[model samples]
Target: MKMLAAVVVLFLAAGLSDSVILTKCGLKQQLQTSLTLPPNTTNVLAQIVCHVQLTSNFNTSAIKTINETEKPHESQGPRRGRSAKNVRPTKVTPKPHLESGEDKNEFWTLYGLFQLSDHVVCNSTQRHSLNLCGLTCNKLLDNDISDDLACVQVLINKMTAVIPDPETAKHIHKMISLIYQPECANAKASVYFADCPQP
Candidate 1:
């Protein structure tokens, strides 16, 4: 009986330590700097920030669900609480911590995804385009657009909708091509140390 109790305790400890907890969540501000992004772009970039955060949330939730399911029910006695009748589980994943530096993947990595420093020229030319892209992307994402190509379309279609003044429209039109080019299309999303791109 003592041996069995020790084994059970060890199992509980392991599960407790293994929970899918996140350590920190904000890396958005760092990338928002003008050196990497324009000041006015914050609103549009906010959309991107929301996008990555949603992805992280989904990850945490899915992990929680899966972890909960995989764990065997807690041991129960006839007198245990009502929950004891079901398979009560100890948390298997650690909760996420919100501090940035502590967990690169849980915080800093996702922060990088919102960093749009790579193409300043393309970005500048596409400010309206990008902002419009962000709006449309949020809309489509609300409706569901997981792949890269679909997101690119969101930008293009939104740009087409409200034709801006000639000069700005001309710039937006230029951005349309730039966005779909392989490099931009293949832009990476930094997901807490993992690549959150579609296969």
Candidate 2:
């Protein structure tokens, strides 16, 4: 019995090792390499770092499920005609259980560091999704963050394409603020990146 338990523990640990919790500097480095910011927009990197810290606390496997009831009418299909400027902040809540014969217990889940959504971004087996990111939700939950960064890049491109040059930075900042909690809008990098070594 002791040997069996040891094996079981090892197996569980191995399974849990798939995800990673990145440090502030580590994440900043990853973003620096993965993202392509607009010209003269270096400050946006700090904001991006803060946004990830607030959203998932740098946990690569972080998952937040928003039930259909919380986001009514969104379960039908991908949200269309919604620009980056109008994106709403995600409301984090515990996964709810619905009784049988009730509406489908579909949930629009946010995955990984950036909390990319299943309804509008990544595809999942749970329901019909737009899959704008053209990748699986599971892909976002691993130690690898290339897929997450790619999806974010797609969003940034879309946002910059519509807005004029003068308002580009403001619009991008506003869009980032809207996607996360209200506090993220005012978050300072110094607060979150205090532990990271200066460049």
Best by TM-score: 2
Model 1 per-residue lDDT tens digits across residues 1-199: 9999999999998765422323223333333332233344434333443433323321222212111111111111132333211222233343454454664442111101221111211122322232533332223222122222333434435454787576556545544433232212322335332322222
Clashes of each: 18, 0
List clashing residue pairs in candidate 2: none
Model 1 is weakest, by summed lDDT over 10 consecutive residues, at: 107-116
lDDT tens digits by residue: candidate 2, 42-115? 55666676666655667888877766344222322343554322344344555674556676755557788887
TM-score versus the correct structure, for each prediction: 0.21, 0.66
Go through the candidates in order and give the C-alpha RMSD of each one to the true structure: 20.7, 9.3
Question: Which candidate wins on lDDT?
Answer: 2
